[model samples]
Target: MTKITHFWAFFTFVAFSLGLSNCRTVKNGLDEKIYNG
Candidate 1:
């Protein structure tokens, strides 16, 4: 049970990171100066 919990946490983190990356790219594209000025 503990191992399963750890695995789920890791999976969730990875998914969250991926989602964030996608959003960041879209945001930068919309306002490149704000993010990469």
Candidate 2:
């Protein structure tokens, strides 16, 4: 039970980090296009 809980927590953390990185990349792309346009 404890191991499963730990795995779930780790998965959630990884997913959250990936989502944040994706958002940052999208924002950077938009900024680049706006500035370059």
Candidate 3:
């Protein structure tokens, strides 16, 4: 039971970090487009 809980916690952290990085990249892309146009 403890092992399963630990696995899930690590998985969630990884997913959250990935999501944040994706959002940052998307925001940067939008900023560049706005500036160029």
The lDDT values for all models are 0.94, 1.00, 1.00
Give one digit per residue, the lDDT tens place, for model 2 in 1-37.
Answer: 9999999999999999999999999999999999999
Q: Deviation in angstroms for 29 in model 1?
A: 2.5
Question: Which regions of candidate 3 are displaced past 4 Å?
Answer: none
Q: Which stretches of candidate 1 lie over 4 Å from their true place?
A: 32-37
**Better candidate by TM-score, 2 or 3:** 2
Q: TM-scores, in order shown? A: 0.69, 0.95, 0.94
Each prediction's total of clashing residue pairs, residues at least 3 apart in sequence or on different chains, is: 0, 0, 0
**Residue 14 in candidate 3, Cα distance off native in Å:** 0.2
The candidate that achieves the highest TM-score relative to the unseen native structure: 2
Alpha-carbon deviation at 12 in model 1, angstroms: 0.5
TM-score of 3: 0.94
Candidate 1 residue-wise lDDT, 1-37, digit = tens: 9999999999999999999999999987889777676
Clashing pairs in 1: none
Model 3, 15: alpha-carbon shift in Å? 0.2
